[model samples]
Target: MSKGQITKARILHQAAELFNQQGYAGSSMSDVMDVTGLKKGGIYNHFKTKDELSLAAFDYAIATLAQHHRAVLRQHHHAADRLLGIMAVFSSFIDHPPVAGGCPLMNTAIEADDAHPALKARAQQAMTNLRKLLCHIVDTGIAKGELQPAVDSDVFATILISTIEGAIMISKLYDDPVHLERAIAHLTDYIDEYLRI
Candidate 1:
């Protein structure tokens, strides 16, 4: 990569963690400067406004997460195993997170709602993509006779996403990992006993 490209990536990486942790409203230009060790002009040269940086940072974070999910999902052949793989990825966050502050989708969704329209839209799109992926997996499973044909893919996708996101939020709020652990257990059971054919 070129010098400018490297610097911009560095800025995005640092800014993503800061924004995820402190949030868009809480993080300041100085904080970005501190994190990147770049002067005002250097930062402004790459991003015209804080909003631009926030948007880019969010994309970077989400893209990183999607890459991780793809890696985990690739390991499992069956749809049920793939679904459990998703749960395992989220459960792993209790100990080691892909990003600094936890799930970017959950964090951005909570903070961006009614505050940052662009960020909120980005978060919404991310969820939509996730749900679509889950639906496809479940649908494929049913077609392959691996999952019950009567199952509603959309409902299952929504429930899985909601359960995991809720668990992440509760675990973070209560400063306890057990909440996520229980949620993961329930999700595992749901996949194996209920969804599997």
Candidate 2:
């Protein structure tokens, strides 16, 4: 990477953390400057506006999450195992998160819903991709005879994603990890009792 590329990445990295932790509205240009140790001109040189920086930061955050999930998914060969691995990734967030604040998808979706169109759209696409990934895993499991043939991949994917995301939300809201733990336990039961062939 060139010097400019490295600098831009550093800015994005710091900006992603700040935005995820403090939120778009709550975080300011000074916060970015403070994190990146860059002056206003230096920051604006890379990003024309805060909105531009926010969109890029969100993409960076989502990409970070995708990378982590991909790594976790690679560890299991069985379809059911892969699904459980994915669940484990989310469950791990209860104690250790890839990023500081928690799930960027949930955070951005909630904060950007009515305010920022571009950020909201990015979050929506990230979620759509997540759903597709889960569906693909379910379909692969069915093909391998690891999952019930009658199962609807999309429906299963939706249920799993919704359950985990809701669990994360409630856990964060109450500052309790047990909610996430119980949710993952129930998900595991559902998979073993209902989805497994």
Give the alpha-carbon lDDT of every model: 0.92, 0.91
Error of 1 at 55 (Å): 0.3
Best by lDDT: 1
Candidate 2, residues 1-197: lDDT per residue as tens digits? 99999999999999998998899999999999999999999999999999999999999998998888899787888888889999998887768877778888888999999899888899989999999999999999999999989999998888888899899999999999899999899999988998888
Which run of 10 residues does model 1 get worst, by summed lDDT?
Answer: 90-99
Q: Quote the lDDT for 192 in model 2.
A: 91
Candidate 1 achieves a global lDDT of 0.92
Clashes of 1: 0
Error of 1 at 125 (Å): 0.4
Q: What is the lDDT of residue 100 in candidate 1?
A: 88
lDDT score, candidate 2, position 161: 84
Off by over 4 Å in 1: none
